[model samples]
Target: MSHSRFESIGAYLPSKRVTTEELVSQLQETPEFDLERITGVKERRFRDTTPENGEDSFALALKAVQDCLSRSQYAAEDLDVIISCSITRSKDRTKMYMEPSFAGAIARTLGAREDTISFDLSNACAGMMSGVYILDRMIRSGAVKRGIVVSGEAITPIAETAVNEISSKYDLQFASLTVGDSGAAVVLDESVDESDRIHYIELTTASEFSHLCLGMPSDKTAGVALYTDNRKMHNEARFLLWTDTQRNFMEEQGLTFKDEGFDYIIHHQFGAAAIPYMNAIAEREFGHPMPPDLNVIEKYGNTSSTSHFIVLHDQLSQQSIPTGSKVLMIPAASGVVGGFLSTTISSLKV
Candidate 1:
């Protein structure tokens, strides 16, 4: 059976952006927290300039899909499946699953066929990658012909909630500054040749660390309340959670950090600090420094599961990645870690 492959990928970020300095200045004026010292984030993206009624995850998803379709020159009707992987969704006045049919709303907005397979996938931060894996398997089995996977993370609400909770509980100043907002989309097709196919994809879960990074809403109607497991909400646990999973994933692939086999390493862009930690771990395990192209955290922050594909799209457009280059996509969600290694055979150039 022939495996399905990704023909093209696209990403869309909101026009409104926030820099760390700006965030710090605003926080300092309020006296609720000192955001400069504690937070590791230097910048983040938001859908709306105003926090109250900012752009929503669904809107961002629409924009991302539109970008992907336009860039790939593929019409919405061409899609056989449309999967939206998101933690944020439209809510009713009572905060219930407003549309219950949110996926249908997305599909209709994009002009997808009435028979198109459309649904939502929720797996914390691993939704995007997980969607890709599922679609790949289905297409390979000839269950689908072409599909689209999209992710939109409107983390601002969660970040704001975290900031308020941490400030009220521990009197901390910089807790909310760490979260970032982002969204991405990828187009998959069974018609693509095998030469451009995904080489290997792997996903693993360490349920033991499930409590390490968690999101709980103080009130069911409110946004997420970020907290750490072990009753110690520190950054160490977050690092350990990601590092441990990454190590296990690499070992499973028989890949040592020292191997320069991959031209680019697209990791979960957690933060600037997380990138160095990943590189250090890779060097120690592989006994050598990671390749130069293995970095994307500095600019995009951590886009959860979309981090890997976002970097993949950016690098492809920058001429930094050449055709037929091998790329490794390593992503870790709250409870799962996934690794996808694929080669670029099609010329991204016009």
Candidate 2:
């Protein structure tokens, strides 16, 4: 069986930077908590909505894919699959699309072969990792030679709603204010050796806690909104779902957490405080200190499905993570989903 690895990575952050203070100043009622201190989001990127730019979900995906392809050995015509894992599917200004499938649209735009498999999947913020998992399995099974897992999140509309509707610091919509816009893509193909390959990836969903966070048309507004019970979603038990699942998986393989030898760990950029707390819990549960945590939340906030790849691309771009470093990515998404992805990246570059 062939092991799959990341062949290339790409990310695009909008040029418009909105500071936390600027974002909170729009709130009708001043929040009691320190937004920047709690979220570690001093600023975030807002997509350019100008008619000339047209940087919607589709456009964002296109730009990231272009960047990825620029670094990849394969062209669009050589790709066997394209998976779109974006939660927000806006194609036009505030206009959401579900029909022709974002994957199909991207494939057609990029001029991929007609036989190239294309589809869209949504698993909340775990969407992109879920895409990688599926593609990795497909490659291992020899179902395809190569594929692209891509997401373009134009997710700030929820923040707009939060600014308009939040009544206090305790409002469920408060969490929505942390979101930013971004596009990220990764090309995956068979690995030649263990030095550059995805060792394992797994995801689990605890449906009972699915109600803790939800995105829907606003109950009392003109746009979409996100309602997240951060108190419940970021609790100790909720965080344990990831460590516990990984622990079981490791035991089944006769391995310990430290046996993986990860050089860096990347968590979903939900909040600055929540990540350290999650890592502390992991240390207690796994009986080992975690690898260094990497994140861009202070500048990019939570970019939803694209968060992990964005962090990877950022670190690679800055040459902070060496080529052969093993990285661990943990996903915490709505649907109360949790997962761990371990990989050693060597040839992948942003």
Candidate 3:
């Protein structure tokens, strides 16, 4: 049976990089600020040139998709599916939903056929993985020959708000300053040779933990109340707390603390603080130290769903791993955790 394979991957980071010092300087000038700690985040990328109003997630997806098509030999007309997976959206103050429909706008921007499959998947940080799995099933069923999964996460605004709120409430300075912005894209197709395609994908969920990390719509009433009560800010710490659950899931996958059966490991970036713990767990389970370069947390920060693809794109561009290498792409979303094991097939060279 033919299998779905990732043919190419691409990523785009905004030209404007805002360092912690710069952010602190700006914040200090305001009445609500004071001395702060930036933790380990050196800087984060922001769009150098934005639309008159602003560049939303859809626009970011378009630019990244264009780059993907240019780097690979694929033409716009050859694409059979387009999936826009992002946590952010474009909307007006009065409008309830984002304008232009993310999937439709991306399809038009890429000159894809009207009949081509197009849609948006909002799975928080696991959106891209969900999109990939959906497309994989379609290709396996002969519904489409080629598909693209794109994510444009301009989480800076939310991060900014979350950080400010967290800092104001808890008197903590480092956590809010570590968030960053990024975008990424991936191209998948049916592989004529099963040897070069996605081999296995396992997904598990802990819905009981769904409330751990959440983004509630802003409410004037609650906003005013939260300003005085610090307890509300504690939810922001959910990302850190979720690490224990992720470790448990990894163990269940038979990926013991030190197993090295997999040649490459790509995971969602949570920041420098989380990397050492994950690396240590992998080493303990695998019985060997993970390569220093295995971590991408330092540069990109935490990009939610785009984190894994960003690392994959970087590794592929550098040819860091040889063809036929076995790589594991792992991502742990707020309520769900997923593991995808794929082989770097020889066909990827062509």
TM-score, every prediction = 0.81, 0.99, 0.77
Off by over 4 Å in 3: 24-40, 49-54, 91-100, 167-176, 219-260, 282-293, 345-350
Clashing pairs in 1: 33-173, 258-286, 269-302
Query: Among all windows of ten consecutive residues in candidate 3, which has the lowest summed lDDT?
Result: 221-230
Q: How many backbone collisions does model 1 have? A: 3
Residue-pair clashes, model 2: 0
Q: Which stretches of candidate 1 lie over 4 Å from their true place?
A: 26-40, 49-54, 91-99, 168-176, 191-195, 219-223, 229-260, 287-289, 293-296, 345-350
Query: How well does model 2 score by local distance difference test?
Result: 0.93
Residue-wise C-alpha lDDT for candidate 1, range 150-241, written one tens digit per residue: 98777666666644444333432233456566678988876465456675565667576676676666553466665544223234444455
Candidates sorted by TM-score, best first: 2, 1, 3
Clashes of each: 3, 0, 11
Error of 3 at 216 (Å): 2.5
How do the residues 1-350 of candidate 3 rate in per-residue lDDT, one tens digit apiece? 56788887777777677776666655433324232222346666755434454555655677778877776668777899988888776433112245556777788867888788888888878888888888888888888899899988776665455444442324333343555667788789987765577865555566656654555543422321111121332333433333354456567766553453567777666555445565565565445765544545556566777888777776667777677876766676756444544455554531
lDDT (C-alpha) at residue 72 in model 3: 67
> Which candidate wins on lDDT?
2
Ranking by lDDT: 2, 1, 3
Find the 10 residues in a row with the least total lDDT in model 2.
Answer: 49-58
For each candidate in turn, give its C-alpha RMSD to the true structure in angstroms: 4.3, 0.8, 5.2
| Residue-level lDDT for 169 in candidate 3 | 25
